[model samples]
Target: MPIIEMKQIVKIFEDPKRKTNLLAIDHVDLNVEENEFLCILGPSGCGKSTLLNMIAGFEKQTSGDVLMNQKRVDAPGPERGVVFQQPTLMPWLPVWENVSFHLKLEGVAASIRKERAKEYIEMVGLKGFENHYPHELSGGMNQRVGIARALMLNPSVILMDEPFASIDAQTKTDMQEELVKIWEKHKITIIFITHSIDEALILGTKVAVMTRRPGTIRETMSISLPRPRDVTSDAFNRYKRQILDLLKEEGELAKAASRSSS
Candidate 1:
């Protein structure tokens, strides 16, 4: 069975001024298999994040159902972990405390929390900085702390919304490599939302492209390229070109809609 499933999802937002509903997702169906790294790509305002939020149980769809492990998702639970674009860590807490916050909430012992945090801290390569506060670490390191915190829950699925979008180019590349390594080692299912074509091509086992507003799955392409993908290779370029074309087409359509509305 698919680890995560969405059938005929439709999301509508009230446009108070216009007094009309704005459709954000239109009859979209998606599925994520176990241990698959699925990347969702689309132009801005295309409901990519909205879709992820539905799976995380942060948003309720107007119609249709979201199921994880065959159970309906009505509220957020430990079974699905989410990492937002920002680190969203507590400023006062040190690295270890931040990563183990969930355990603390569960009433786990301090010693056990510390030990558990240590494992993920090392996994994300923050071994020596456990004592440092969020303000003391670089943006990339802080994001790693967020990843560690999510992983500490041992959730069946991890939902990431452009987690590396704010880091420097070099740091983003490094983090991508680290993320792929972590995914391969842990074999966790991930639903990642991004606007970058190259980033999607590099990280995903399958890339699902969505259309502009009222987003629907335009195409879901299997990325059979081997791990540690070579960005400059012919196969990589081929996939990149395909995704680029799709995005370009969506961009044009969005522009046309805007012009008509104006």
Candidate 2:
């Protein structure tokens, strides 16, 4: 059974000024298996991020259902942790406190929260920097804090929206490796959204390529690559070529449609 399922999901946004409706996602169905890392990939404005937001319960769909753990998901909860592109950490709070913010909400004792937060902080390699605020950390380090914060909740599903998009290439590669290591240890389900085909291939057990605007699933490619994936390997190149071809076709179709509409 899948840990997360979306059945024929549809989302439409209204343009009040233009008196028209914008279709963001079009009857998309998706399933996420337990402990699997699934990546949603597509070009910009393709609704991949929108689909992720719906799963996060940060946005509501026009129709269809989102089910997780055999229960309907109507709103956000601690069970579903989200890590946005930006760190979104509190500037006033130090790294330790930011990681323990969820516990603080539940009225947990300071001592207990601190102890729990320390474990995750160390897990992300920020052991000595707990006292530093968000401003004191580098972009990659801040994202590490975000990841640690989500893991601290022991969430059933971790949702990451292009969390490393803004980081340098070298740092992004490092973070990807770190994420896979953490995932192997925790075995938590993750729904990650990204536009980079390489990122999707490196991280996901399955990659769902989406169509351009009014997005729907174009194809879902299964990846059986071994751990510590070799981005330069022949097999990796084969898959990369295939994904690029698909994206190119989708891009052309999107351009034609826009031209005709205009």
- Candidate 2 lDDT: 0.92
Candidate 2 segments whose C-alpha is farther than 4 A from its true place? none
* Runs in model 1 lying further than 4 Å from the true structure: 260-262
Name every residue pair that clashes in candidate 2.
none
Candidates' C-alpha lDDT: 0.94, 0.92
At residue 230, give the lDDT of candidate 2: 91
Report residue 106 deviation for candidate 2 (angstroms).
1.2
Model 1 scores a C-alpha lDDT of 0.94
- Candidate 1 backbone overlaps, count: 0
Candidate number with greatest TM-score: 2
The sequence of per-residue lDDT tens digits that candidate 2 reaches over residues 5-65 is 9999999999999999998889999999999999989888878888888888888999999
Q: Model 1 RMSD to the real structure?
A: 1.1
